[model samples]
Target chain A: MLKDKKNYKLIVVEDNIGDFILFEEYLNEKIENPTLFHFERFKDLNDFQDKITPDFDIIFLDLSLPDKNGLDLIIEVQKISKQIPIIVLTGYSDESFATTSLALGISDYLLKDDLNSTTLYKSIIYNIERNKNLVKIRESEQLYSDLFQLSPLPICVYDIETLLFIDVNEAAVNLYGHSHSEFLNLKVDDIFHDEEIDKTEEIASKIMTHKKKNGEIIFVDSRSNTITFNGKKAKIILSNDITKSLNHIREIELQNQKLKEIAWKQSHIVRVPLSQILGLTQLILDDKETTQETKELIIILNNSAKELDKIIQEIITKSKEISLNE
Target chain B: MKHLFIIDDDAVSVLILKKMLSNADFLETPMVFYNGNEALNFFSKNYTSVDTYCVFLDINMPVMNGWEFLDNIQTTIHPNNFMVYLLTSSTSEYEKSKSNDYHCIKKFISKPISKEILNEIKEVFNSI
Candidate 1:
């Protein structure tokens, strides 16, 4: 009979000729003009492992091969065709072992006694589609995990109920001075100052103090949100260190106070001597016993003192304005 | 009608001011105190009259400063009993502006107290 053409490349690993013939007959009923590759020994499939370009759509593996059988054979075949869906056909009727094989990454497990065309066809189609979805889910999960782990800011995930740390990024480890294993042993309260830990649950973001592993307290700007982590209700915290900025502001305020004190002294101290000069010069000038030339010299001296006083006044006035602004 | 007073530590400043007051024909002998503490002490002991006194109060003094004297006097006597004129060689705009905070401080006078200033003071008291 001329087989109808519905091209699908398939691989079958079987030591038994009888089972091989039966599987081919069953596949022929469903698939038309299928390219089927058969390997009698497990070692024979290993020879063709590097030869295949893309891969076969499905692999029917007989667990009881000449060299390798059961879980070991499934593992070996799975290593070569990591992305391809694998179905295990075995003569053993042990349902427990069949279940064990499925857990070990085999897509489907069928006994040779119960194998039929319809059952064989259905297992191949369903498992291939299922494997595709699983691969997509795994890739997406990797993408999200990479985003969290590789973040630049210090971040951590902690269980909401237990308040225990579930995971922390590299940045968090370096910032808090705690190793990954050490952090796993710590609760959320361990990093926060005693008074501030209670507020973490109440507020989403705030500036607060935190303690590092070395028992140093630092100011931090913390932002947090609730999220599901490893199937547990947890909170993710992103914190930025602000200790340096706070210290900078404190330094500026201290400098401003010092400057104000200097200005106040300038306005007061300089005037003491200037007052003496003015008072003395005026007394000398108003004296009737003084000559005209001596009086002119005293007047010039008085003008110089007054000019110096004006400059000091301008400084005091500017400093006062600065103090008022503060 | 106003009484005249001079509160200054400098004897030369006191002499010059007293002469200016005599020239201005101020009738009273013009009560004098060397420093802010002495001035505050005099006011504490004496009965302050209803009539205002024109006081040429010097700023920088040994016992107590002008600002301290003003603070003490605010609680001790009525604000209207004194017409305070702050006298200083300091051309500081800061202290000048600060004088406005005391309502009793009528004027900020930078020394040397000339005849024109004495006449201005006379006119101000006469007008009041």
Candidate 2:
């Protein structure tokens, strides 16, 4: 199939001029308009550093360069070829050195004896594509790690079967009063108050009290989800500290209890005196009273006492309803 | 006619009730006790038939309250023979609902009892 006309930039960091020509010959067979930049030594590449833009797709590094060689050369080349794929070309067929060179971030280790158009062409295409995928994977991993570590709320991953914490973010270490290593040694139950687990559903998120490593119990609204962590079934817990809010609710409840007690006393204590006033007035009205003026005064006194009683009753009833609702 | 009893600590309440019953011309004189303990002592000695006695019970006395009196009375005699009316200062809904649990308690009346209510109580006893 005919491919799209694309400009390909390549760098050959080989000191041997004959090997550089052989690489160009192989690359020319597969690629069209391959811009080749040849640097004979590590010092030569250092001088060309300012020109080392990201436009270069791949770097063909000769391990035995004039200034640098072996693993040292591969590391130095990596500094300039950030996202570019680097293929190590060597006259030696030493498998151990090639393995070591690959470990130092060289994309592929190619032998000079196996230099053919098809072999070089395949290595270039495969390593470039593979490097692209590796870069993408690293970026996504960095994004996830940044989100986890920099979150304001505490977050942790714990092995579901053992309940042991697999990982804890910075906020979790601060909130739970445990170092990362200390948290890894603890189970989920160890970080929670006994009553907290009793009130919480095993599979659902809830608000409950948690015990820190230093023995301080705090309220936290937490969510837990089943997840896979390093190939093990684990749970991710996200928690927001709610101790202050819970304390506020407790304080309000205490105030409400005192209010209820006062309302209770109003129902009983206040009515005692009021009942006496009513009884005394009734006795006066029944008395073969001596005068009409005395009767009228008693009638007014009785009505006032009844009105006061009604007001106290209304207050007590309303408060009782409030307490009952709670 | 059934014998009437008033168990109360307050002097004015007992005095007012006496005058009201008299104004209504109730036949039997009500036997009065200052506290629930005194009423319980009287019932322990004199309790013979529930149908023959009617009590106007009060709460909040020094020796024993109305609830204790009710509890004590139930243990000593048959629950059906006596008719109890709670006549007290408490207008609390809690106490009112609690009074329903006692089958022997025929009515709950918050004081002060009028002559009309006294006549009505007399008519109820007459009908029974």
Candidate 3:
């Protein structure tokens, strides 16, 4: 089959010699562009598992294999790969048998008596297509689950508007310290500061206003606008815990407040001494209004006053260092 | 002359609504109530008149909710004379759908009624 074509590989796990020949003739006579294999017992699965890479598109299963009878071996075969579609071919065609087969992830079931070459061919191709879709769906679920688990940002999806938490990721559970069930029970008020939550309707408005998960308002200067937590809208929220970033901002703000205080002192308190000096110099010049010696002394006093003014100006100008000190 | 009623718990919100509606010449004068029960009581006493066309209702007011007021008025008074518009800050989608469950409520308007929404009110009244 590999030498003639590059297509799906099929595994037939039927113990009956007659049924094995029938599967072969169906592929050879009824199926076109198909590759086939037949087995008498469950050992062939292990044998094939060792001899070749397990990449069969379909596993045509018989419930009564020589050694492995009933639904157990079909499940064992199913564990191989959900992508490898297992269609059970059974003489025992009952609802219970079909139910068990389906519960065990057998893609479909076929009755051996009704197994014409056409039915076999159609079943093989149909199972192959079903297997492809199953694989695709599984891949997508895994990919999304991977993102939900590993993404750095905390994310959760809830029903829209009901705000009932539907699905939550590991990051969301970690950030909010909530289990999936616990998150489902919470409302918009549970996470926020109670006084702040007096205005929860406002937060919902903000969420609706900035539909992007990233838009934020300063909660405390140290707060990030973008933490997604439990909202009752049954909305999905993806929040990144920026509490650390917010803390850094608060530290800087406290520092800035300190600097602004220093700047105020320099502007007013520090300049008070210069004003006293200017007053003293004016009074001295006023006391001896017309002497040349007094005039020289006044010039000296003026220069000292200017120096004091410059010092005050420099303190005011440089207090902006509070910004850099952060 | 058209008479409107203001049902709000917050004094400031009711004051603003009254002052704004008066300035807009939207009514002769809107009667004000600080809670849903007071407004329902006023309606019980005054339901015989047909001039009250609008009730600017706050949903979270004490004594009774906006939904309860609608329910009470159904048995206690005829709603043919007045239409209630829910101007609330609640963004709950459940609340939006549940409002449809009440037969007397014409529409649920969200909070902080901007100029566009108040203008829509005028359009609804002018057609009458």
Candidate with top DockQ is 2
* C-alpha lDDT score of every prediction, in listed order: 0.82, 0.84, 0.65
Native-to-model Cα distance after best TM-score fit, residue A60 in candidate 2, in Å: 2.9
- Given the true complex, what DockQ would model 3 score? 0.01
Candidate 3 structure quality by residue, lDDT tens digits, A1-326: 32224365777888888888876776666544666676787887766665434466677878887778776786677666444677887775554786677876678988877778778767877877777787789899899789878887766665545545567777766666767788777654344442333221323222211111233322321112233434434444555555567679889888889887877666644554454455445444544455888778887987888786777667766765654565
Worst ten in a row by lDDT for model 2 chain B: B46-55
The clash numbers for all candidates, in the given order, read 0, 2, 9
Worst 10 residues of 1 chain B by lDDT: B19-28
Question: Per DockQ, what order, best first?
Answer: 2, 1, 3
Clashing pairs in 2: B50-B81, B50-B82
| Fraction of the reference Cα-Cα interface contacts (below 8 Å) that each candidate reproduces | 0.38, 0.72, 0.00
Residue lDDT tens for model 2, A141-227: 999998998898899888878888899999999999999999889888888787545312344667877888889999999887778
lDDT of 2 at B109: 89
Model 3 C-alpha lDDT per residue in residues B45-67, reported as the tens digit of each score: 87765464678887776789777
Per-residue alpha-carbon lDDT of model 1 for A1-326, expressed as tens digits?
55446577888988889889999999888878789999999889999898654456788888778799777777788888856888888775666787788888788888889989888878877886897798899999998888878888899999998988999999899889999999999999899986546533645678988999999999998988888888998889998898999999999999999998888777766676676677668767867888999999999999998898788878888898988898
Which residues of candidate 1, in runs, are more than 4 Å off?
Answer: A1-60, A65-69, A72-84, A92-95, A110-125, A196-201, A223-236, A262-266, A270-326, B1-64, B75-83, B88-98, B101-104, B110-115, B118-128
Q: Give model 2's TM-score versus the native structure.
A: 0.75
Q: Model 3 segments beyond 4 Å from truth? A: A1-8, A31-37, A50-55, A92-96, A140-153, A156-166, A179-253, A281-298, A311-326, B1-128
Q: Going through the candidates in order, what is chain B's TM-score?
A: 0.90, 0.92, 0.86
Instruction: State how far residue A78 of model 1 sits from its true place (Å).
Output: 5.3
